[model samples]
Every structure is written in structure tokens, then in C-alpha cells.
Target: MTSPRRTFAIISHPDAGKTTLTEKLLVAGGAIHLAGEVKARGANRRARSDWMKIEQQRGISVTSSVMTFERAFDDLGVITFNLLDTPGHEDFSEDTYRTLTAVDSAVMVIDAARGIEAQTRKLFEVCRLRSVPIITFVNKVDREGRPVFELLDEIADMLALDVAPMSWPIGMGGEFEGVLDLETGGVSRPEGDSRNFQGKVDTDVTLPERFAEEVELAQAGYAEFDAEAYRNGDLTPVYFGSALKDFGVAELIDALARHAPAPRPQPAEPAPIAPEADEVTGFVFKVQANMDPNHRDRIAFMRLCSGTFKRGMKLTPTGHGKPIAVHSPILFFAQNREVADEAFPGDIIGIPNHGTLRVGDTLSERADIRFTGLPNFAPEILRRVALKDPTKTKQLRKALDDMAEEGVTQVFYPEIGSNWIVGVVGQLQLEVLISRLEAEYKVAAGLEPAPFDTARWVTGDAGDLKAFADLNRGAMAKDRDGNPVFLAKSAWEIGYVADRYPKVRFNATRER
Candidate 1:
């Protein structure tokens, strides 16, 4: 039998301590001895998940990271954890959205001081739409924060997620002692200073001696936590901790093993897939370019939904229907990777991409089912990319194609022009693209403001879409996937086109 598996992503608003929580969880799982801070100064000491040079310089995650580790728990034995650490910044939310399609559940980190932020709400709605089970972590309790009750209420009110306390904070700020395990009813305090707390949690210790008054006050106002509701996804079990101090992290891991569901069935186009199916099946949710600077390699990250993946197995990609060798399957720990012999359901594996695979493409041994729900949101910002050196035009085009294939940004070709128009979620993305062009591809590029501020996909009958595209050739383009799109200068332009073309539908996102 397969070991219990929990594949989840960690999500939060920017500066909510999501990266710190990711490091602590890896530390708790014994993947690494010491958890490095995201902003560590030393050349060799940085957060494992933030491996990219740009990420290290900016001190923010710009790309999604895949990490897999195994831990032995007292109740659940050895379980494999495939943790997808996603970017919290809204500018890179398109990356986060794609990563969410590859995970079974998510761990949403909420800053106790600032409850229910914009990015948090956006990511939560994505999870809710997929019915992904969520476990909340109330982070940065080592500092003064809002009342726990109020924070919980805010999550319930803003995100519509019910709250269940798995572990309650003893106190906040300077008086911060530790967390009380509600199931065991024991207070576990940090043994040392805020910088390092290495002692084992003494669950046998009673709360009265250390936090008698605080616990009493907390219990007086706290309502009963329903464990059943938590498991049902109706209520998210909340764990409070200072991730920087490593307090209550172990408890969070334990709760995840005990409560989080394991390798649930996934919805596919033709049918839903069970975890224990006989044949192997999976879908590519992410494609990354230039992971290795020397080779300029591309990797397709696939989430195995059913059966087993074997080395050198030939499986048919859903759309192509041609057998492709599953060559050199790899698993990731930050930037480091190892050849994988076999992988089970709920496992993420990377296959070498030679321009053959794409995001939302499915692969299987005996089925032609496609997985749904991977989306391409309309780009809010548009720009035209220009190469500094005209001699490197081929290199520039290749780099743009690679990045566009990775879903880093959307690339569109005008109906009548040879120039490429870039569509991005924010100005920062365009900057990042230009930076990557210089750093990774050794080509300097610049962006000029385009006439369009918004882009929408043209969806309707083939004839109608063609007529619209032909009529507005200058303002019309095709995306990387060859989908027709209309670039509009303003809301009035979008309305004008919509009113004129009654048969055509303008969509903010492309349906899978």
C-alpha cells in the first residue's frame, strides 16, 4: 500500500510570513537541519525555497517551488509531503493560480496583526472554487496582534471559512509564552529565547502553572472548536505560532497528518480519477524554463492523479495522442533534483520538456481524458517588447517563446504585424521579464507602453470569431495558445465591441 500522502500549497498575502512558515514546516519534517530566513544576508544562507537569484535579491518569492519530504509521525507512521510553496505577491498570482491546480489542499497563512488581506482572499476563493480543503495558520503571534477571536471572526466573515482552533496561543507580544493544544489540553512553551527554541514540547505540563490566567481568559471567550467541521472543509482548523521562533510548528505538522485528507479523487474532463486506478494518469500544471542555466532546459511539472509512473514509460499526451517517452522523471527540493524511479498519486514529478508539453496538457497510459480548471486570466497590462541589439533578434524571440510557454507572461501576435505584444498582470512582471532576458538569456530587452489596457478572449462560433478578428485586425491578436483575443484601449472600447458584435462573447478568462 502507498504511504499516506499530503500534497498542499502554502498561500498568504505578501509579508504575512508565508515563506517563514514554509521553512519551519520543512525543518519540522527533517528535510533540513536549520531553517534559513528569506532575508538572510550570507551568500550561502538563504531560504531553500527561494532559490532563484532574482528571488534572493528581492527577498520575495517570484516563482512557485516544489519540495517533497517524508516524516514519521506517532499516529500516522511515515507520510510523504509534497509541499508547493507559491508566490504571495499579487503580481505573480497567475503563477500561484497554476500551482493551486496541482495540489490536493492548501495551507493559508494569515498574519495575526492583519487578518484577511486581499491576496489571501483571492487565493482562498480559488481554493473554494476547487473544493480544496484548507488549514489556516495564524502566524506572527510572537508580536502583538489582534485578538484571536476577532481574527477568526474576520476570516469567517471575509473569506466565509469557518474557524476551528487546533492549537490556541497562550499570550501575544512580549508576554508570548506558547500554544495550548486543545485536543490534549496542555500548554507547550518555548524553552529558550525568541531566536532559537529547540526543546521538545512538554505536552504533560499543565496550563495552570505557566498561563493560568491567560488560558482562563481565552477559554472564557473561545467557543467550542468542532473537529468534524474542520475535516469536512466547512471549518478550517487554525493553528497559532511564531514561525520565526519555531513555536507550534511541530503541532501543525501533526495536525496535518491526522486531519488532512490523503490523495483524494480529481476531476477530469471525461471522468473523475480515483487515486488507486490501475493505469497511470497525470496532467501538466506548470512548465518552467532555464532551470539549469548551462543547458537552458525546460521542465514540465505534472501532478500524478492516478496509478504509478515508471521510468522510461511511454504514455500518450492527451491532445497529441502520440506516445512520448516519460524520460528522466525528477523530484524537486528547491533547485536540487533527483531522478525518480516511480511516483504515486498526489506526487509531483518533473519531465524534460523539448517543446512538446504545455500547461493543462494531460498524459495517461490508457485514457484520453483532459483535466479542467487551469485558466488564463485576461491581462490587465499590455506592452510591446523590443530588443536592444537587433542582431540578437532570434535569441529574443526564442526567449520570449520560452517564457510565454512557461506562463510567466502572455505573448500575442497582432493580426497584421510581426512585432510581439506582451500582456502581463502588472508592471513588475514586465520588469522581471526584461531582467530575465538579460540575466538568463543574455539578451537585453525593453518594454514600451502599448495602446491597450485590457485584453479579452473572443469566444463564439468560428465564423463569428473570424469575422470579428478580420474586422478589427489591428486591435486583434492570437495568444500563445493560438486563441483569438481583442485588445481594448478602455472600458468604452470593450463595451463598444461587445455591443457591435452581438454574436461574439468577450471573456475575461479562457475556459478549459
Candidate 2:
């Protein structure tokens, strides 16, 4: 038998305190003693388990960080948590989409004052599309002035979530008192001693006279929502806290262990390939590149979607060359990396693999299984680049190749004189590419402004193509459904010149 595990993601819009909440959770769950803040140390902060340096400096998470923490609940001695802290920015939204494939549920963090923003809606849609359970956390109640009740109402209306409070703030803003535990009816306020209030919650704190009626009405509303959800089939439960001040955090942890979906022996590992009858399968979600004085290693972070992975086992990765050692999963705890010998179903395992295993590649004991590759993403932006010194031109190519291998961003080499373009979704990504090339490969690259190209493809009737040739003007084309096609740059957009159109003809200037 295996200890129960919960696989969930922490997601939010920018500056909503998702990472801060993550650090606090790690410490409270006994995973780490010292929590590092991204702002305090710039890059000196040991890159957290999932976040990279580029993310910390920009104060934005591009890649979802994978971390595990353990806590005992009720009679269960050890509950393992495999958490994916997803990026809040729209540019790295693909990272969040890929995470949905592995996680069983999501903890949506909404800024209390801002209520629900654009990215929050997008993230919620992703969770809804996948039918993953959702647990909403309303954060940031410590900022000078905030309306607690109004924020809660706004969240419910914006997210259309049946808001249920597992814990509620005892006060508001700077004078914020404590949290009222919904289940245990306890209050734990913020103070120097707040961190010490772990599993033991105080049930006998008297509510201030001003909030007495408000608390009662709020509690009643929460009970009604929970009761209705229970009557139906939805299991999602909402909770609240000030992540910055550590208010209502312990209760949130308790709710995570108690209410969030737990890993079970899935009947079959999910695969997108044919026959649909196959053994369990899993995929590597992240890879950590570590170079130390003694050893240089590449750790593949995997999700066990189907079967179990044991220590010292050898397995072939899908769509890649040879077999690699399964040296064991690892936990980055107390500034030390230790090997975890066995990984059960739904567990996020970090195995030592030197082979080429991309983020979305799948792994399975049975050769017959395969899943649809990771979700598709549009590379909408491009930049022109040149080597700072012509002497390092060759080295720049090699540096770009290495960056591709590490999954930094998509790189394409066009015609010789063509703008040495690199495709990314945003500007910050371009900067990281340059920094990585200079730091790791000793190649300095310079960036030049490039015009944005609209991706277009031809898929309509050839008869209408005649109109296109008469004008000789090109505009971004959309499909019948209006979705821009992927990899459209390489696709042919045929514009027929006359009323009589040939089924297919290419202009001489068009690249074959």
C-alpha cells in the first residue's frame, strides 16, 4: 500500500501572491525550514524547485514549478502533495495549459482588491475545460484598505463559483485580526506567533462586536453553498486568506488534505493513441539542469498518470532514442536533494535522465500506449538578432541549438540573409534567450526590432481565389471557425487572380 498523495496546481494572475503562498505552504508543511522571497535576493535566491532565474528576476513565473510537501491528516500519517505553481502571465499561459493534463485539481488565487482579472478568467476556463476540481483562494487582505465581503461577492459573481469558505478572515486590512476555521469553528490571528499556530487552532476567540452579525450571515451563506454542492456532485470548496500575513493558511492546508482530489489507482493510464486499450502511461513535465563541482546531472520531472515507477528500473522514453536509468525521484528539502525510491500512481517523480525527454513526452511500461502530445501553442512574436562579434558567429549557432535542446524557446534558421529570427511570445523571453547564450555559451547576441507577421493559411474554395489575384493584397486569413491556424508561416495562402482559378498554383516569389 502507498501513502495517499494529492496532485494539484496553484495558479493566479500576476502579483496575486501564488508563489508567496507556495513558500509559506512548504515551510508550514515541514518541507523546508527557510523560505526564500523572490524580491529579496534577486538571483542569489537558490532557484526554487520549479521557478528558474529568468522568472525570479522578472517577478513572474514562466514555467510551472513542481514541489512536494508532506503533512499528517486525521489518522493518516503522511499525505504527499505534488504541487505545480503555474505562471499568472498570459505570455506563459501555455505552461499553465500543460499543467492541467497532470493535475487533478486547481487552487485559483484571486487578488481580493482587484477581484477577478483577465488571466484569472482564462485560467478558470482551462480548469473548467478539463473538468478538474477547483478550490478558490481569495488573497491579499492586508493591503491598507479592502472590503472583505464585497471581494467575496465579486469573486462569486465573476468566477460563477459557489463560494464556500473553509476559513474566513477575522478582521480586514491592516487591523486584520485572525481567521475563523469553517469546519472547526476556530480563530487564528496574525502575530509574531502566527507561524507557530499549526494544527492546533483556537476555538474560543470572541469575534469583535462590529463583525458579529456579518460573520453569522457569511457563515450561513457558506453552509448553504456547501450543502447545495454536496447535494449535487461538485466537490470544489472555496477558502480565503491573506497569503502575505499568513492568515488562514493552516486551515487552507487542512482543506487541501481533506477536500482536494487525492491520487487513486487510476483504472488505466490515459493515452490518446488508438485501440484505447493499453497499460498505464505517464509523461515528463519538467527537467532540471544542474552543474555542480562533483557531478553534472539532468533530472526529468514526471507525472505517473498510470503505473508505478520503482528504483533502479530501466525504461525507454517515447519518441526518443535509448533506455535511461530510473535513479529515483527526488525531493529538494532543506537545501539538499534526496532520492525518493518509489513513485506511485499520480505522483510527480523527478528521475535522472540524460536522454532527450521533452516536457510533454510520455513514458509507459507497455509499448502500445501513447497520448496526444502536449497542448499546442502559437509563437506569435519574432525578433531579429545578430552576433555581437562576427568571430563568435559559429558559436552563436551552437548556443541557439543548445537552448533549443533545453526548451528555452522555439528557434528557427531561415534563408542565409533572413533576419536571424527567434520566435517567442513576449519581450522578456527574448532577453532571457540573450542572457542564457552569453552566460552559458559565451556568445553575445544583439537584438533588432522586427515587424510582426500575421500567420495566414489558404483553405477556402478555389473559385473565390480569383478575387485574391486581382488585388494582389494579402491580409491575415481566418478559418470558417475563425481560429488562426498553427505554424501558418510555412503554410500556403493561395490567392486566385482571375474568375477562373486553378485548383493549385504557386507564385514564383513564394518559397517552395
Candidate 3:
């Protein structure tokens, strides 16, 4: 029998100590030797999970990366954990939403001082929409922060989640003695100048009398930690500690191993797919290209939904409707990878391909089954590409097409001319586009202001669409998939055109 898999994603706002917590979790699981090894140590060392020249230089994760590691539970034996770390920037909401679909649960990391942030609430809503249960980690407790009860109340009021405190901090900042282990009724604190946290409750060391009273009140304040309520998405168990200080890292891992759900059924067309179903089914949530500059490789990250998958098995992707043998299915530890001989449900496997597999595509043993719910929203920011050297026009187009396939940006060709327009969801994407063009494609390019402010995928009766397009041919374009799109100069223009053609649908979102 296969080891139970716990696939989850870590969602938080940028600079919420999420990256530190991720490295610490990997260290606690014995996936990597030192936390410093997984994270960049000095100025030159790159964090193992973070790549991309722009990401390294800017110190932000712009793309979703996967790291798989296993931990042995005394009762459950060895549990394989697939950790999907998402970009916390609001600019990457599209990517974040898609990543959430692939995970059974999520860890909501909150800054201790900054209780709830805009991006954090947005991502939490995404999880709530899918009823994806969450585990809350109130990070940075070692430093001074908002009162513990206040943070809990804010979580309860803002996100409307029943917040349960699994672990409590003693005193904060200079008065910071240590963290009280609620499970053991003991305290664990940093030792010596090195500040090495033992991550174990010292039975001999008792908590201060006043701190003990506070702990008693904290326990009685919120709803008790109920496993069923958590799994059902009604409540979230909270843990407080500083991720950078390596505090509560072991406890967080233990919480995940003990409470996180195994492979859950996936939402699909016709019917939901059960994990125990005998057919191999998975969906491509992300398609990344040029991870290896040397080979210019393209790998599709697939979240296996059901059945056992073995290398060299033929699976039909809905994108092409043709069965292809997956000869080199790879498992990831951040950027590092190894060819996987076999995988089970909830395991994320990478299938290296040229371009047949795409984001939102479903792969299955049969050609008929198609997974649902992964959709691309229309881009909010649109710009035109001006090349420094027009000689690399063909290469630029290929590069843009590749990036569009990765869902980083959307490229549309004007039906009337060869001029291309690129659309992105955020301003940061514009920076990424220019940076990637220069660094990855060796194409010096600059983005110029385009006339269009927004785009919509048009659908309806062919005659109605044809008439509308003919009337507004100047604003008409087609996406990379040849799907007709209506580019509007402003939100007002969309309403005007939308009123003109009631029969035609100008969709803000389109499912691939």
C-alpha cells in the first residue's frame, strides 16, 4: 500500500515570514540538513526553492514552487507531504487561485504584529470558496506583537473562522520568556546566545504563575480544537511562534502530520472523482518553461487525483485529446527533481513535454474525463511590446507564446495587423515580462502603452459575434488559442458594447 500523502499549500501576504517558516518546516521534517541550506545564507547564496533572476534580485517569489518531503509519524508510519508554496503577492492572484485548487488544505501564515492583511484575506476567501480547511500560524511572536486575544478576535471577526489556539506565547519582546506548550503544560524557550530552540517542552521547567493564568484564559476563550470542525472548514487551529527563530517549527510539522487530511476527492465534470477510483486522473495547474536555462525545458505540474500512476503510462490530455506516454515523470524538492517511477493520488508529478499539456488541462486514462474549476480571468493591464531589435521578431513571438502558455501573461494578436498586445493582471507582471524577455529569451524589449485597458473573451452565436466584430473590428483580437476576444479601451466601453449586443456574451472569465 502507498504511504498516505498530505498535499497542502502555504498562503500568506508577502514578508509575513512565510519563506522562513517553509524552510524551517523542511528542516524539521529532515528534508534538508540546515534551514540555512534551504534558505539563502549569504548575499550570493540562492534559496533552494526560489529561482528566476528577478525573484533572486527582488527577494520575492513570483511563481508557485513545489517541494515534496516525508516525515514518519509513530502511529501513521511515514507520511509523504507535498508542500506547494504560492506567491503571496496580490499581483499573482490568478496563480494563487489555481494553486489552491490542487491542494487539500492550506497553512495561513499571519504576521504577529500585522494580524490580517489585504492579500491574506483575499487568499483566505479563495480557500473558503472551496471549503479548503486551513491551519493558522501566527508568526513572529518572539518580537512584540498585538495581544494574542486581539489577534484571535480579529481572525474570528475578519475571516469569520473559529480560531483555536493550539500553542500560546509567554511574554512578548524583551519580556519574552518562551512559548508555552499547551499539550504538555510546559514551556520551551531559546537557550544561550545562539538562541537555539530545543522545540521540546521541558517537563522540569514550570511556567510562571501569571503566564499560567493567561494560558488558562486563552484556552477557555476560543472554541476548543476539534479535528472534525477543522476538516470541515468551520474552525482553524492556531500556533504562535517566530518562523525565523526556528520556534514552533517541529510543532507545526506535527500538527500537519496528525491532523491534515489525506487525498480528498477532486471536483470534476460529470461527477466528482474519488481518490480510490481505479483510473489515473490529474489536472495541470501550472505549466512552467525554461526552468533549466541549459535545456529550455517545459514541465507541467500535475496534481494526481485518483489511482496509481507509473512512468511510461499513456494518459490523454484534454488539451490535445491524444494519449502520450509519460516517460520521465519527475518529483520535485523545490528546483531539485528526480524521476519518479510511480506516484499515487495527491502526489504532484511533473510531466516534461514540449507544449501539448497546458494550464487547466486534465489528463486521464480515458479521453472523455475532463476536470473542471481551473479558469483564467481576463487580464486587467494591457500593453504593446516594442522590440529594440526587430530582427528577433520571430523569437519574441515564440517567447511570448511560451510565457502565455505558462499563464504569466496573455498575448493577443490583432486580427487586422501583425502588431501584438500583451495583457497581464498586475503591474509587477509588466516588470516580469520585460525581465524575462531579456534574461531568458535574450530579447531586449520594452512595453509601450496600449490603447486597450481591459480584454474580454467573447462568445455566443457566431452570426452575432461576427456582426459585432465587423462593426468593431478595430477593437477585435484573438487569444493564443484563437478564441475571439474583445479589447475595450475602458470599463465604460465594455458596458456600451455589451448593451449593443445582448445576444453575445463578453465573458470576463473563460475556462480552458
In order of appearance, the predictions have TM-scores of 0.91, 0.76, 0.93
Question: For residues 1-512, could you state the per-residue lDDT of candidate 2 as single tens digits?
Answer: 43377888888888888878888888788886655763346454543543454565677676667778888877767788888888777666655776776777778887766777887878887777666778777776555334666666666676566766555555432233334333344433444434322221234444444555565666676434453362232534556677766776786787677666565333222424221223446776655554221354666667776555677766667755456666666755423567877776667767665546656566776444455535434356756677778888777776665444344555554322444556565566677788767655677778885443323333345554445433333233222223322122332322322123444233221110
* Cα lDDT, all candidates: 0.80, 0.59, 0.84
Measured by TM-score, the strongest candidate is 3
RMSD in angstroms between candidate 1 and the native structure over all alpha carbons? 4.1
Q: Give the least accurate 10-residue stretch of model 2, judged by summed lDDT.
A: 503-512
Models ranked on lDDT: 3, 1, 2
The parts of candidate 1 lying over 4 Å away from their true place are: 1-3, 38-41, 172-228
lDDT of 3 by residue, 36-134 (tens): 534456853665667788988887788999999989988889889999998888888888889998999999999887789888888889889778999
**Over the full model, what C-alpha lDDT does candidate 1 score relative to the true structure?**
0.80
TM-score of 2: 0.76
C-alpha RMSD (angstroms) for model 2: 7.3
Higher-TM-score candidate among 1 and 3?
Answer: 3
